[model samples]
Target: MSAIRHALTTKRADDFSAWYQEVISAADMAEESGVRGCMVIKPWGYGIWERIQRLMDDRIKAAGVQNCYFPIFIPLKNFEREASHVDGFAKEMAVVTHHRLIADGKGGLIPDPEAKLEEPLVVRPTSETIIGDAMARWIQSWRDLPLLTNQWANVVRWEMRTRMFLRTSEFLWQEGHTAHATREDALEETHRALEMYRACAEDDLALPVIAGEKPENERFPGAVETWSIEAMMQDGKALQAGTSHYLGTNFAHAAGIQYQDKEGGQQFCHTTSWGVSTRLIGGVIMTHGDDDGLRVPPRIAPHQVVIIPMLRETPEDEALLDYCEDLRKLVAAQAALGEPVRVLLDKKPGKAAAKRWDWVRKGAPLIVEVGPRDMAEGNVAVLRRDRLWNQDNGKPAFSFVSREDFSAQAPALLEAIQQALYDEARERRDANVTRGVTSMDQVAAHFADNHARPGWVEVQWSKPTSAALEAATEQLKALKLTIRNVPRDAEPADGTCIFTGAPATERILVARAY
Candidate 1:
């Protein structure tokens, strides 16, 4: 096992991309599948996803959104109804040509020549088309407006590059589709959904994110306006954590969804769609993980605390086990009271310290070790992953706490850990953003020298014309990045443009994003 482990190589400091793959695989979270761009999320990884689902599902329910199911295969014509929507997804769709297969003489199955679909079905990259069709049939009057529904399902989008949870061909997510009588209501829904995503990312996932609108180039294909929550990873690259799109009446018009107003006037319904996918798992890993491995937030960690029995062949092994078991029961009882504590006793035969390290690599927030020494003294050794050991102070990585009183104190410790992680991520984000640039030279210099910040430069793109902005966008693209947002409060500046020094009005966030 040691030999096999030694063969594995990961670039901890120099190659963050490789390090991510190594840590993910080493922790047994997921594995690459036989199918390109797909992954097999292992039990441990799926456990995290399940926790995310439980939390987000509750939020969706509270927001007056009803859960519903839509078919995985959408008719080709339904997709084309919304031109921009189709254009965005056209390149990524996987179409089904034949419906049946038969065994050939050589024993391999072959597509039956007689079984061609009348209208080739496209595996849904997203469900907006089919959902809009449903709304068209179900909505006829103003009373039926604001039809809010959410679907938790898998979507397939073929991609050239893939990561375990970040970018995959198929992944699980919840997409919300709503139709409102007026544009204002639809806009409200979009912001509300974006706010929910922000809360989930910060409060639940413990990752701080900036909530704002996407630049024109990065907006969702069919959306009139798109908003997103962006979080910076440990490596300084931005992650588009979640998105909410105000689709206007585009889909309603395309799908023929019209509602009668109070005055008996027919009008197209305004629509909104928003989603957060398993890519959040990637966000959590990048935001909190260290060189050791993944550091999941205590709230979302599958195993929040682990108890290890520091037993040896000395006559006290049995006593240590008993003490550890008792501690586990105490913690479990506290968890039953809604404190969200999860504990595991490591009874495997081996070096107890090594077992503790194993749990640390798995990102358990807390570890408790019981031995004859500690058991005899009515205490257990406690160690926290969040608290770094101070060599200057001569502090050991582990400390001692009374086993009887641990349950009462554990909750506070976990809360401290949660706060510390959030603060650290916030600090990183603050340090990364750059601000107050008035020239194109400043933008170019910042991008070349510091990717982390000046975090975002507030610049006036003097020429707000589409052609000039597009030209600047092309230049930024060469740097492998783009603008993130246009500030709502941007004012026209008399100064020269940042890129061309022409006359400029708005400030935009520019960054290389995932």
Candidate 2:
């Protein structure tokens, strides 16, 4: 009936990028660290990351992978052993030349020339080279095959351009590496990792993703094949949420990871590396954030339900807070998403309305407020982040319910929110994908305007090789798009290739990505 004023100053429609940055700030998730291409993840942001880590680690360990840590500084010689790996990351690697620092006499410190080591070290961008060396030492026979290991760590890439969580110079992530005895086993593990990412992103994070195989040109530097889970952001751009690379024997050969078989012969192990990073947080913001702020999916929300007592700083405030505390305990006891509900009672000194908006902006799944009147009536006012406003009144869509009833229904409500977010994202993604485009001309025309929010195009392709592939890539580059992936469940191609005009073999998704 009337215009609704949103909590956020920036609206997604007006400018998505600015809106994204605004959400990060208004939600208290993160901010620029004053260093180029780096950010400081605040408590709320790190809390979300911790939840994701706990949930994802459970999934990783369930697959029989063991946790381990590696040195942050990898020897330059280690990367030199893998030419392709070095070539791929050369521009981004942060090299450590000297071991110590000295005063420059100008009140600043500089690397001490005298402390230079015989060999330079590279801050790890990825662990393939270093992990390969460990696998080589740890495995000597078939009994040690399928050595599964993972590490949660930070990596430096020296990015020239960065956003808070999306593409920073440094970011946190979990990298899974495994060595298999045969090519078949390695491929299976790769697919398993991809499926794991798909399930985690969809079920846990409520970000529906398309799991697919990347083309040769998009594969990891030394990988034989690479697969990724791509999620569509609200702005119609694709975010590569996670990737699983079937490295084959490339890294094993580089690190000399050989094992003796029952036949008494030595063979290089086939390897796979897969990872998901903080970038998924960025995906969540773009996928579920509204004009008001972020609408975090319940499964990954640090605090699913937050109770803010409507404190008046009077004697009656005690009773309201006591009632809210009881409600918090009840909600916390209830199970949701196969875990105990995480609910917080905000007893901090603040106005209830102010605190409610604070939690709302932070994307807490549910916010409950109890006043003296509500306490006397044994009721609470609840606001669902996913359904924030009532257009009829241009006000917050608050529901009044008895405390006992709300506590009993908390688990189901959370599960529903998680499913609803996933459904919304999936529907949007499916609708935006333009299918059955037959030619490069059509694809170009469809995304001709740079400012237009053209989602993606599914077209038939011959899966060209070498020079032909390069030419096809240049054509797409001219349109500021790239081949996102070839969906694993796509229909068999029945038309000619859009680029080469040859008989098409598979369907590939083309889109502009983050």
Best by TM-score: 2
Question: Please, what are the lDDT tens digits per residue for candidate 2 over residues 1-514?
Answer: 8789889998899999999999999999998889888899999999889989999999999999999999999999887887788788999999989989999999999999999989999999999999998999999999998899999999999988888899999999999999999999999999999999999999889898899999889989899999999999998999999999999899999999999999999999999999999999999999999998899899889999999888888998887777888898899899998999999998999888888888889999999988888888889999999999999989999999999999999999999899889899999999899998998888888998664579988999999988999999999999889999999989999999999999999999999999
Candidate 2 has an lDDT of 0.93
The RMSD of every model to the true structure, in order and in angstroms, is 3.6, 1.1
Per-prediction backbone clash count: 12, 0
- Candidate 2 runs further than 4 Å off: 449-452
lDDT for 21 in candidate 2 is 93
Candidate 2 lowest-lDDT run of ten: 444-453
At residue 264, give the lDDT of candidate 1: 99
Please provide, for model 1 over 411-499, each residue's C-alpha lDDT reduced to its tens digit, 9 standing for 90 to 100: 77777887888999999888887767776666678878844343555566654557876888888888777777664345546566677
Clashing pairs in 2: none
> What TM-score does model 2 achieve against the real structure?
0.98
